[model samples]
Target: MGTVKVLVDDLLYYNKKDWNAKVGKAKKDNVLTVVSKIKVKSAYIYELISGMYITAATKFLKFTSK
Candidate 1:
């Protein structure tokens, strides 16, 4: 898959070392928010691939669960 150009653009916009450094996970809604002067929408495929009965953290936990 091709890397999203917007991701690169966003990276340049913030010049962050990593995704989490630039974007943040919302505590209340658990939504990922890009913490920068620019506005962008953030979504992950796992949200749709998995059942709606889960949250991003839950999905992440399942993937990394041992």
Candidate 2:
């Protein structure tokens, strides 16, 4: 899954009900949410031999999952 941060118009009333109401209105209007910024994070795993099972798993997922 991926995530993005966006900026939205300020609520006329800074209350839970008002905020939810504005959000529902925006959704119904198909308002586009602008992504102001993005941050990505990843991890690297290293294995010397990658094991038979690991290699087989990769192959199966790559070739047969479609």
Candidate 3:
């Protein structure tokens, strides 16, 4: 699995892939394990290990391969 680091404070988390619902927040500098990735239109979304969803925006996240 890969990893993603939150680049912005209080980044929003979604409970679903559509990103229509807000579930929780992840703080800046938080490193999350990425279980999978999906593309929604022009943006990418990551499914975390904890089953939370976050945007893969470069301005808000930094991705790394492991």
Candidate 4:
């Protein structure tokens, strides 16, 4: 989550947008406001990969509730 957030911050800064524009889930949605389609795709990929890793780790450790 932290890694993804950092990537998002970089994306926001790259686009000259507010670094902390919103809070919680709203922040994630702000990525769409980026003008460059390529940058948006890159940010989404970064977030997806980070989330995948987190999901895999949680499953490996059996931390998720059934």
Candidate 5:
């Protein structure tokens, strides 16, 4: 529908932390983790297909359960 934008903070700007801790198992997992910080200018679901799914999953986990 519209453009997708997301603001991420404290993201892995450097290659710090363990591989699992830094990137996790899936790339999507890392992306979701990063998107969690985007309170403003978050990516729009309609604009993104796959990327939004990861963010949506992150939000679901944050709101629904562990």
Candidate 6:
């Protein structure tokens, strides 16, 4: 398991790894538990325990091992 801190306000979270499904939003500085990491195309996406997907880009999140 891992953790990630949201770097921007109202960060978009998705329901699918394809990023075509809109789910909800997460606030900045919110630390979330990551269930897993997936690579879609050339981008890495993180799957939260809540079943939400978010970008794993360094500019958007700060990742840490738990």
Give the worst 10-residue stretch by lDDT in candidate 3: 15-24
**Which has the higher TM-score value, candidate number 5 or candidate number 6?**
6
Which residue ranges in model 5 land beyond 4 Å of their true spot? 9-52, 56-66
Clashing pairs in 6: none
* Regions more than 4 Å wrong, model 2: 1-24, 29-33, 37-66
Q: lDDT by residue for model 5 over 2-66, one digit each (tens)?
A: 22222333222212222222332222223232322232244321212233322332332232222
Model 2: per-residue Cα lDDT at residue 9? 29
Cα displacement (Å) at residue 58, model 5: 12
Could you tally the backbone clashes for each prediction?
0, 0, 0, 0, 0, 0
User: Candidate 2 has what TM-score?
Assistant: 0.14
Question: Which pairs in model 2 have colliding backbones?
Answer: none
Q: Of 3 and 6, which scores higher on lDDT?
A: 6
Query: What lDDT score is found at residue 13 in candidate 5?
Result: 27
Candidate 4: TM-score?
A: 0.16
What TM-score goes with each of the models? Answer: 0.15, 0.14, 0.90, 0.16, 0.19, 0.90
Q: Can you write out model 6's per-residue Cα lDDT over 1-66, one digit (the tens) per residue?
A: 899999998888998998777778899999999999999899999999988899999999999997
Give lDDT: candidate 4, residue 20. Answer: 37
The reply for model 3, stretches above 4 Å from the true place, is none
Q: Order of candidates by lDDT, top first?
A: 6, 3, 5, 1, 4, 2
TM-score of 5: 0.19
Best by TM-score: 6
lDDT of 1 by residue, 1-66 (tens): 111112111111112322343332323223232221222235332221111212223323222221
**Candidate 2 C-alpha error for residue 10, in Å:** 17
